[model samples]
Target: MINLNHLNYCYRSGVNVLHDITAEIEPGIHLLMGENGAGKTTLLHIMAGLRYPRTATECTIDDVSTSLRLPSVLSKVFLLTDDMVFPYPTIAEMERYHAPFYPNFDAALLAENLSEFGINPRDSINNFSLGTRKKAYLAYALALRTDILLLDEPANGLDIDSKTVLLRMLSRNITDNQTVIISTHTIWDFQNLFDGVLVLSQGRLVLAEKVWTIVKSLAFVNSLEPISNALYLTQNMGRFQAIVPNDGTLDTAIDYVLLYTALHSPQQSIITQTVKNAR
Candidate 1:
């Protein structure tokens, strides 16, 4: 588990990007959701020990303090950012130089993933398109098999077919010992892969809970009209989507987009309270 407490961060220009955030991230695929400039990337950097928190009572991964950036801790964590640049000319060259850093790196898995994405490891990476590059990097990242893998906007440059391949790879590749946190705006693409969610608003952590708990605590429904007692509601394509208290009788699949919208709306407290009471 990743343990954080009272974490705060500020840019060199004196702009605070994160504030007093504390949450435990368990092992699973968790969706990190927030609006633009919500400090998602900053938080990921801190977690990976690439950036230190300005002031934190405690911030550790598996009890190891991340601020120190020790080799022991760093070896088990990998952060794949949106704008990745490789000095190597090809995927094979990159892997040859970098794979040693990650003891668990699986060369076979990398080759398999590359094949699935229709990428040539020997081809110069500079010549590949943006989508192909992203796929290549994703394959390498997954093969690292790090204990903590943080992906920022992982699906940004993918086409429809590539996205489908990505979803399939993620579903089959992640192990129970691994904790993968994906920060993205395209929630619908990987909706089924999320085992939990971490939500940030402005600079604060508003919600951090398992998907099962949220599902048990609330009911997400679709109706012809808005439910008067709904904690939150939104209109979409002439139908109304709503979040209401689960009465132990309603079995509804969560509309993740609607749940995210509700958490950022005025009715956030009501929904949170309902979940807390259930727990």
Candidate 2:
């Protein structure tokens, strides 16, 4: 339900944030992964229709790309950042204000989520803890039932228990028609949460493929010397790990974490065209 073709973007200072990028997305959980200053959030902002590129990027949703900023488009796209202040409304007042904007907004669901988090709607947002406010925002965002939900660092600043709760709620509540996209640096938290992985390197699209396909194209090896034509390699606790071409000749399981480390090494970046085109 999303498409970005030949996208290019830069800041007014002429600092290039995103190079030419092309990507397509369907309805599922897509994990956007990148290091610091890798333009993951920038890409999310562009996709949310809040920020526009200086040049044409050819972004489309549901076969339509032009009308991105309209309320109709905004209604289907929800961007959740870390700066939610909850406005000046008490929980009750906030719901009343947002009720008309979201056609599918469910007050009962929001209440249930708040109850699960042990949050009281009568309390003022300023008085609530940071985690509590985040919980409230999460509940409200899910209640909106937007077709595309953009979450930037959704798992940050939450307790371990709350993170688990967030995961469970996401698993249970997200509908089939919805497409959830999360951009974060800590990939370990996902732990089988992603249907596909979108990897960005140096402001360019590096990889976009299903995790299972990644498992097949690359294999983890203990020594780089034994592998044939190693493209990416890394050292872990004195042991070497490498990403090797999977020609179906070796029957071994691919360790993704190890492969990712090798693929993202700064000294020797090796996101080959062959590997990127695997999808």
Candidate 3:
């Protein structure tokens, strides 16, 4: 498990980016959602043990504190960013140079994932396009076999077919003992992959709940006109997508976009109240 308590971070210019964020993430696929400049990347960096938080803040994975940056902790966690840097020209050379850092790295799995992404393991990495580089990086990341995986904007450079393959590979590869946190603005691309949702707004944790509980607490409705007691609404093609309090009768699938919109609207207080009441 990962535990974050009173986690706060600031830039060198003394501008706060994360404010007292706290959450316990279990072993599962978690989707981290936030608007631009919402501190999602900053938080992911902290989780990856690349950045240190404020003095009073504490962040830990299991019993290990990430701020320590010990080899033992580093070996168990891997962070994949949108912009990746390669020191070697070819995939084979890169793998040879970096594989030692991760004791659990699987070369066979790496080759398999690379092949699935249409990337030749013998191809030179120096001339690869952004999309190709992302694929290579993703394949390497998954092959690390780490206990904790953090991905930022993972689908940014992938084409449609590559994205589908990416999703399929992720779903098939993740084990029950591993925890994966994916921070992305393109939530729809992930669709039904995440089992939990974490939302950050203006550097604060606005929502953190299991997808099942969220769906049970709120109902997403599509109607021609506004419905009474609707928490939030979005117009689409002369129709509306609305979110209302779940009354145990509506079995609608949770619409992440609509739920996110409602959390930022005037009904946020009632939404929070409902969540608290359910607990």
Candidate 4:
């Protein structure tokens, strides 16, 4: 488990990024959603021990404070940033140089990931395109077999086939011992894969709950006309997509996109009140 206790970050120029954000994330696939400058990347960087908060805060993964950046903590957490650069000429060389840092690095799994992604380990990584480089790094990151896997916009630069392969690999390879936290603006891409939803707004944690719990608390309804008491509504193919309070009989699967929109909409009070009562 990873814990973020009253984290507050700022830059050298004194521009505050994150507020007193606190959340306890359990083992599973977690979707971190927010707007462009909502501090998602900052939070991820702090969790990876790449950045430090201005105030003394607690960010720990399994009792080890991430701020320490010790070998034990570093080996257990892997963060794949959006803008990644590989200096190595080939995948094999990169593997040989960095594999020693991770005790559980699986060379065979790396090869398998390369094969699955249709990438040749002997090919020069510098010559690859942005999407290809992302694939290469993703394979390497997954093969590290770390307990905490943090990915930032992992599906950004990929074709349809590559995205499918990524989804397949994540669905099949994630073990119970590992926790995957994905920070992405495109939440609808893999909504069903997430076990929990975390939404941040203006540097604060606005919503955080298990997907099942959210689904149980609210209902996603589609109708030709607007619902009389919808907490949030959007247009879709001549119909209205709405979020209504679950009355214990509705079993609608939560539309994460709609939930995100509702969290940011003017009528957000309905959702906040209902969620509070449900809890």
Error of 2 at 238 (Å): 3.8
Runs in model 2 with CA error above 4 Å?
55-57, 220-230, 247-260, 266-278
Which ten contiguous residues of candidate 2 have the minimum total lDDT?
Answer: 267-276
Indicate which candidate wins on lDDT: 1
TM-score of 4: 0.95
Task: Give me candidate 3's TM-score against the actual structure.
Answer: 0.95
Query: Candidate 3, which ten residues in sequence have the lowest lDDT sum?
Result: 270-279
Q: Which model, 1 or 4, shows the larger lDDT?
A: 1
In the range 1-279, model 3's lDDT, one tens digit per residue, is 888898999999999999988899988899998888999999989988989886523788886789989898899899998875767777788788987899989899899999999899788887788899999989989999899999999999899999999999999999998989999878888989998889898999988878878777788899998788877777888988888888788899878887787887788778767765655
| Candidate models: Cα lDDT each | 0.90, 0.75, 0.87, 0.87
lDDT value, residue 13 of candidate 2: 84
Model 4 / residue 137 / CA error / Å: 0.8
The parts of candidate 1 lying over 4 Å away from their true place are 55-57
Error of 4 at 75 (Å): 0.9
Give the per-residue lDDT of model 2 (tens digit) for 1-279: 888888777888888988888888888888887778888888888888867776444676776653357777777888898775666556767788865787778888889888877888777878777887888778778877889999998888888888888888888888888889988766667666777778777898777776667666665567734455767766667767777777656556645466455547752245445455565
The residue-by-residue lDDT of candidate 1 on 1-279, one tens digit each, is: 898888888999999999888899999999999999999999999999989975433678988888889999899999999997877988898789988998899999999999999999999888999999999999989999999999999999999999999999999999998999999999988979999899898988888889888888899999997787788988999999999889778888777789889999999889888987887
Task: Give per-residue lDDT, candidate 1, residue 61.
Answer: 93
Candidate 4: regions farther than 4 A off: none
Highest TM-score against the true fold, candidate: 1
